[model samples]
Target chain A: MVYSISIFVSETQSAMKFGGKIGIVGAGALGAFYGARLYRAGNDVHFLVRTGFELIREHGYEIRSCDGDFTIKPPVYSAPEDLGKCDLILVGLKAFANHFLPEVLGPLATPNTVVVTLQNGLGNEETIAEALVKCGVHRSVAEASKQIIGGTAFLCSNRVAPNVIIHSAHGFVRLAEFQGSPKERTFAVAQLFLDAGISCEVRESLAAIRWEKLVWNIPFNGLGVAAHQADTAVILADPELRTTAVEIMKEVIAAAKVNGVDLDERLVADLIGKTEIMGHYKSSMQIDFEAGRPLEVEAILGEPVRRAQQKGFSAPRMHMLYALVRRMDQLRQSNLENSQSRSS
Target chain B: MVYSISIFVSETQSAMKFGGKIGIVGAGALGAFYGARLYRAGNDVHFLVRTGFELIREHGYEIRSCDGDFTIKPPVYSAPEDLGKCDLILVGLKAFANHFLPEVLGPLATPNTVVVTLQNGLGNEETIAEALVKCGVHRSVAEASKQIIGGTAFLCSNRVAPNVIIHSAHGFVRLAEFQGSPKERTFAVAQLFLDAGISCEVRESLAAIRWEKLVWNIPFNGLGVAAHQADTAVILADPELRTTAVEIMKEVIAAAKVNGVDLDERLVADLIGKTEIMGHYKSSMQIDFEAGRPLEVEAILGEPVRRAQQKGFSAPRMHMLYALVRRMDQLRQSNLENSQSRSS
Candidate 1:
């Protein structure tokens, strides 16, 4: 299958790359995998980590990948402030962790620094913008939006251990200029990713891109998290779930249209077809839930549902998914609280 | 609130009560609770048990209910053959356990015996009828449905220990003459329940009765299993989930309409209001899923959804629910299998 990866960096523009200092806000699987890749491509990458900081600092990070194994000894820190100002700041934290953005994003970005948020779902760019303004980093939401880029990764990577990442299959992303005009810096960031052996696409249609990604994410990720043991194959294999998935996609297309976004409706078929042959793939939401971590419920499901509702439209499937996934998150939180109280 | 339990025993027949043999099939919480109630009321009750057969046979069953505490040394049987024939056979097994009915129901019921199925969700009557016909205990489905009675229990009971039942609050059921006129036998069964101090109402609108019970069941019971930690109160408490519960109730009402059953649509608010004050109720489906027992997915969810679909109507919420809950059941079964294999 030919992937329309927008445009690759031309030979001339490759030399024009700045190889900017990149600060990764959340050094989970996505951060470590992509950060290590960029670092291997000779970019100065800094990872802001917490739990595995000591292990990473001592032994560095390792990647067991489908693209052959590799390791990188990039700069690692326990706080974003320690990383100083960065030319490009990538936020890979779970959406539940957005409340910590004031502390994370403020010290990591200058006015000129471009922030690429790789978080899933909608309103993330708006969230980062709000955080920037709240922290007095950016005076206005518009300026924050201008300084931000939206990234939707197709990477299949997991932080197996303290300082180890397993890259299974996909390793690429589609980048957009958040809500601003496509500028030279956007392509420069794309070029950095391209240099890391990960396909990068800079699309002018950020809303279309996000909604397109949501076409797949809303049904698969939302249902995967809501269900007990549903992976990609299980979802596709089950007739009822598959039908519900198609209906959700159609509703998503309708929601996008009602929200004044012109997403290619055919993306539904493309996604369904792609997923039909895809093997048993556990969604990130499922993984987060299984690991007892908070899910990206708001960013992925709730925001989109609310967005459609705001525009005088309704997506029942998405709305149900939002409520259910949110409930699941609540249950997990309550369990954690109960356990902690008992232990204490 | 006062309950109106219709008197099936007329003034002339009040003194002609037949304290006949009553067989309690699948002596789970519901069966045990009501059986003990009847036995306490001076009726001959027999329990068909599995695990705690010897315990129940010796110590009998105990009920710790809100009404009062009681114990009864009623007869207990490991198999239906030992119980012989009964005048009234109440099948309170989980819907998934209906497969054992040909063996269980055959030996326990005579042609004159009225079978009251106190199972949740839809299609219990149909399943019992099919099992009876398959075992040659009945001539046809019509005869089987005639011998069977539809029961919707509003009871809150749980078998906490061997030979012990915890009846939390509610202990009432709406009984209907399945596939027949309001015969004297149906009211006699209701009278029996009323005699046991359990509220019993004989409703002519069998469809309306099931649909009304489904107003609460479809949302709370359905969502209870689909979600991670949703009890009745938790579902009623969350605004998003509350909205979803209402939507599902609406769909159930609509499905009933499609099936030529006129249910009061206002029952949605009534059930929600009741559930809001239900004080952290766990649904039977949720219980079954948690206990690693197979869920009544087909009878409880799939049948109703398909019934609506058969009439050229679509129940999106029900379909989504059926898929998710079924997935939860699948996950549970798989987990059990995995654990069993590992232990082996």
Candidate 2:
């Protein structure tokens, strides 16, 4: 498994003692939030931004957070060549954007830099592992996988404006070694977030962490779009839907168990009960699809369904949702293309 | 089971030869199409229309069929007290609108009336059955069920105008005796359609027929809405969606087996192959949802999923789709209400 890492690169070498030189790639909501936190924590943090670079540079990042409000102006770049080498790289991009990583990481990533993934779904680690060997940055995938850290962000924040992010609820993470045990660097990374008033814990197994997070994502994200942008409260309120959500969560837990991760059934009840209080919160996938952006269908839905099927345990709900989302995404793309052609 | 009877009252009861006085209740697409066919065959057919009663009474019915085009100017009535009793009633309303059966069937339906439901999904027969008993027109539900005919329309048609209906493809039906074996009335009804260019056959049991039709309806209807108004051709064209559809069909068959209906797996393949040539045809449920009308969630999806669960078989796919469609329907309704309030 590859980690969806979102590391921060500090400019001052003296501040590197906390977590070393970090490269923050895919600086979307998650990357920007965490990177901003690290930057404000006396570390030399830099951001590799694609969009809103000018706005962020001019106004800085304003975090209207649930905990407290803060702002930080970090170094920003578009090209990876400008960043040089780093001690660690953190990727907070969406799984759908993982395809463009070769261009983003080819020149910037080195043989020694540790990569951590903070994206949703399965196969990100493997994707990064393969991309590493493909780019000749690393000689072998196994060696590259060893340098990766698995991350699960339990944060709820959105970039409300070009230079502003709003952290609504949670701002915590569960970090782990990617296909390996927790290392000294993992503890060091957790300490950095802990020092910044954010909760971070280093778990032993990456697969367990990934599948556990999927317990919420698979049902919520998939159902949100399928239900025509229904929110968490709406889903919890409807009896049939509420039952269906639980069923899908159970299927995810079953798949995790098959993959050697034992999850308690109580976890489902607890998650559902807690989410009931979430009000009308639209999921990330629902938000993306509604905004006419590409969804992370493969990593979030397809891979999990495929993995379960490979183990001879058919997750009917996940497979059905996967197919629906895939087809919807195709239609959206085709419709967009037609409109673009007409405009052209 | 209550039948959704769509019967037409002939003006001249003395001229009841081909099929006797018929009352066409819920004269939407299926009811209007078949009622027109019967009326053309010299039956005393009268329609009880609600929404388009004035338009249909003035212009009659124009059936633009793939087989051929035809027109009929039938007697129309709004109130059941106006139509009197009929020998046979053919129902063509959606399952969601089955609640209005008491108003439609009270005075027009007699104890001797043969109620044939041409609606989709399960429990329509029961709803109609209970409505008959509640009307005090019948003593028992079982007795009322005996007077009901279970019919599955294989035809594809749409009401393009208030009075014009376009029959695009198939014009056939599988007629069955509800809660009873094939009766003489069933054969007579079959012959009536067979005489006219439309194909009709008498099947043994209503439950078997309903479940068989569901083999196609469940997968297509559920996935179509879930996939954001995807049509038949789009579903068949996508390999993933096609596979998921087949799986759902198989689950329907399994649920049917628990209820003593034996359906072959070859049915799924046959339906898929036949539907592959359907082009971009929207399902009735999809059309209802797009038009802001209620879906047949209880009869089509919820009841089926619940039945399967009761039989100790978990249909995860159907359950998930049920939850999704249910949630989507609720959202649409709420959105409609919000829009109406804003406009007001």
Candidate 3:
């Protein structure tokens, strides 16, 4: 029975659609990479960017990937209201930026539009849910057909230029239905991602997978913040920090288990090892730290520990690290804010 | 039974002589304070000083205390051999300096002499023992007659002129016998301290008291090092820092319990509160940090936690703080060392 079902699934995947209109909000490196890929594959990809990033869109959408380089002059939208409704909207802004997703992307998310949140941490789906509710939207069978899916929370190394997003790491994009049964529309969106030359893994256990990504993130991202060190490989090289990272990873695992998402520790460790193979790549949190932007501390560090504590699980080490990192972030923020205040 | 012992103790205390010539190694603020106190009370005192301090001693010892000003011209000895045999010697130096206590103070002690170590932390008594054995001193006591004791560890607000010490705060001297037994000789030493107008307490539970003192020291001293904050009151007044201090205190308490010294949570909190009340006080660690002097990391902070861990105690917070503070200290030391090397 299992063999027959597997064969049937393979045949169905091969026959899926490969191209459609792809709308990307927060058109930075990650957004540009996904948008430009679909555009190059003959899809109508539109990028919605802010004033800071609009300069890049003026030239064109350019992607410098390790595999290949591609450039395209896809239609670019500067604001949510400026763009018309599309088949799918990929939310690629920072996890901290998720709070404003509904305000920025709501105008373009029609009843037929399926929004894919490819952001970090535990709250992407919940943040979108709350935002949708604030936008006066309900999740019915009709709305479910045009729903917001919990998109890939995996690693990606990409950066934006005047006309290109250099993609160094070709990480997979996993897609899944966040609520209820998988509709035909869910499969269509996954098919569209595959058509864009992005590997799409549709899994029934999306929570477990998203949580597994979090297990990798809490430690590596935190290790970077704690040491004020940049890359994942550098952190792993320091024995003191590496042990701390493992402890934090175990904390995330315990939290995930409490939240009903079981993950294989060895598999997570193996996945983490792959990042070391990359040439001097940093976690997004590290990048945020250097950029002097607010970090995803709440979702990535605090929320999971809170969840664990809610289930009466003690995570002293993770909590202490969280406090230290939060203080560090605050220290940086206060310095920036103070300097700005003085200048103004 | 307690009443009968108290009556006998009072009568025995009256006739006790400090027994032994007084020897002070280091002859710094602590050494000057205690040695001058003993000498003024009419006991023969000899100070082992460096070349720099030896010249300063010619001006005479000055001790400015809240009680009154005390000054005296005591005999000064440079090398350990220059000093004749003394019945009792006080090791009055920082924990780091105690490493050389053997070469410096070894020759000054007679066969019957007792070295009372009024130093901080665990395993210091052992350092003295090793120093004695290395000096080829044979005593009837299996362990070296180096009875380790805790100091009042007080503040001297006023500096005695000519390189002598002053008393900033009116705190008492806390000393103890290694075997928790009251020697008629220990009582005599306590009397000399009393005669000098310095309050002294002979404790039976010295180990427990020292650990309690550490529970106080680690939080304030560690934070002082971490934040580079100068005053204890200022650090404690900060709500965030106060919270961090409390967490550190709990870790120390746990460490103490692991080392077979049981300190309750209330006692730990009380000790923390006492530091806050002591207002405007600088920790020894903070003083070392500011002066570019080597910090007593292992003896004061590291060894206690290390010993606790050896006894199977988990001091996660303390262990983390110790690593960070040690890193900071090492980083500073390396920077200074490199700069000096480059300059030369």
Candidate 4:
């Protein structure tokens, strides 16, 4: 099994010299933004869209970027069966929609397919691995895990309308293999993004990068919504909230340390200082909340908190935020259901 | 000075046997309900009205209570000067409106006036005392504190309209002297509520009762607003939120203990159990948030958290709640001001 996995990883790495067939599983703001770039870079990229399938199929995808504008008329699929097998599958779905992974990836993933999840928070890679196993794409969790790569996309983009993505700033991505250190396939995937003009890097520790990203996400994203739809600037403007954001960051750093991922204490200050110049960036969670969409509470907060707690570390602020945001999401879901039922 | 206060306390106690001139400052829902009862009981009660001055004066005040309905055409004063001096002043103002305290109570309070603040959260008595000093009704903070009594009204009431109060249930009040142990003046004020056929009790330790009430308010009221306008039942219904509520209660209890008020740890369970039966009780803060009115964030949350922190104890959940709610209040206020200016 190890020999076959190593062989497949090397083959994937060598194949990265050419623009291999790639599948964009989510095709939302993040998916479409990155996927469009890849298609423009001459990859045979296919998008599996749900809501904007017809709009995207008819009008294609338009990227109104701060870096540069681009358009892609790639093939779009509404279902996994039509997406076809690909050498690389990039999952950019919101963590909340992750439950649909098994069905979505059932036909799209193959034994040699390298799956990269650039979703927020923890557990997306694990979910993808499980989905691969469940969908019979891989024989076991171990086999699936080797083919899975976890990524943190530090991108600021928004899908204002169907088939139209506005890329505001920062499209850097960090990639790492789920099972071990950055493998040959991980570098290959990073190369794909790098070739597409994205600032890409490969990390030895997936947990380290995920925790580092969470050091920013858990506080800013959580507080952005939890603080009554406050943006980054609004949070930084209030001294108490700024202190709270720092406290939350410290808690995340501590949680990361307990989980064997040593994050620098200065990362808190660094992230805050960087965010200070971001000029009122409404976090993705906050945006979802304002749009009355489901938040990635479990993935961004719940999973991290649970992971830390399993190792006997108490993150009171994170726990409080997770509970509050989870409740808010649950309330939003129920409210949406009620309104839908009333209208129907 | 001590002898004079002792003499005044006794005189105040004796004067409680008669109606005596009573001033009801901040005649909102709580003030209107209790003031109407005092008026109905034949006390010389005068209400200091603001927004509802004309409505209350023309139609009188109506109390639709679960206990019983009552109406009173007591004299209503739009300004404090018109309210005149009083033997006892019952303050029911929202803690946010406390800045107007010195101005509002300036003419209504005399050196002989016994002030009882039936407001939520900590620092109300201290605020009252400060207002008395600021208004020149008292020579010093010590004198003001001696005359000020703190009370927590466990009332389920709402002012549905101007001069119309709907009392759902629970009108019991717990009173204590702000300066020392419950003196004659404390019992005298308790008697005033008891005379109006309300459940009222006087306690020895002012801090003890105040902290005890906070054991409920800090969690239910804070979460009631912070958890996206969730009520008591909604908090108890979700297990995570229910757990968060308990954690907040524990923090409050610990805070109280460090501050020299050892609340029984079982108060956590007791309060949660009681809240389970409250049947969707919207806390005063939640109600205020829903109405887009100014929240008593500083009084209910900010002060208690600061008090605990001063004692070198950390209440992470309370601090987070305080920051979130305070930010929400600030955001709401700014939005309101913008709309008002735009309209103007």
lDDT of 2 by residue, A1-344 (tens): 12233333222312334556778988877888898898898887778888888888888889998888998888887778887677778899899998888777787788878888999999999999888888889889998888888889988988777678888999888888896777667777777777777887778788988999999999899878777666788788888878878988999999988888888888898889779888898899988989899999999999998889888888888888788888878888999999999999
Error of 4 at A71 (Å): 2.7
Identify the CAPRI category of the predicted complex in candidate 1.
Answer: medium
The structural similarity of chain B in model 3 to the true chain B, as TM-score, is 0.89
Highest-DockQ candidate: 2
* DockQ, model 1, C-alpha based: 0.66
Candidate 1 residue lDDT tens string, B1-344: 32222434454443446568999887889888888898888888888898888888889888898998988888788988998999889988988888899999889877788889988878889889888898788888888888888988998889888799998888888888888566677777877888888888777767767877777788888988887658888787799998999989899999999988877666777777787787888988888777778988988898899999999987888989998888777778888999999999
Per-candidate local distance difference test: 0.84, 0.83, 0.69, 0.86
Model 3 chain A lDDT-worst window of ten: A1-10
Better of 2 and 3 by DockQ: 2
Q: Which of 1 and 4 is the better model by TM-score? A: 4
- Candidate 3 chain B has its poorest 10 consecutive residues by lDDT at B1-10
Please give the TM-score that candidate 3 achieves against the real structure: 0.82
Instruction: Give the chain B TM-score achieved by candidate 4.
Output: 0.94
Interface RMSD of structure candidate 4 (Å): 0.8
Q: Count clashes in each candidate, considering only residues at least 3 apart in sequence or on different chains.
A: 0, 38, 5, 0
At residue B265, candidate 4 shows an lDDT of 81
- CA shift at A315, candidate 2, in angstroms? 0.7
Model 2 quality (TM-score): 0.93
Ranking by lDDT: 4, 1, 2, 3
Please give, for residues A177-278, the per-residue lDDT of candidate 4 as tens digits: 888787656777877787888888777788988998999999999998888878999899999999999999999989998999887787777787799999
- List DockQ, one per candidate, in order: 0.66, 0.70, 0.28, 0.68
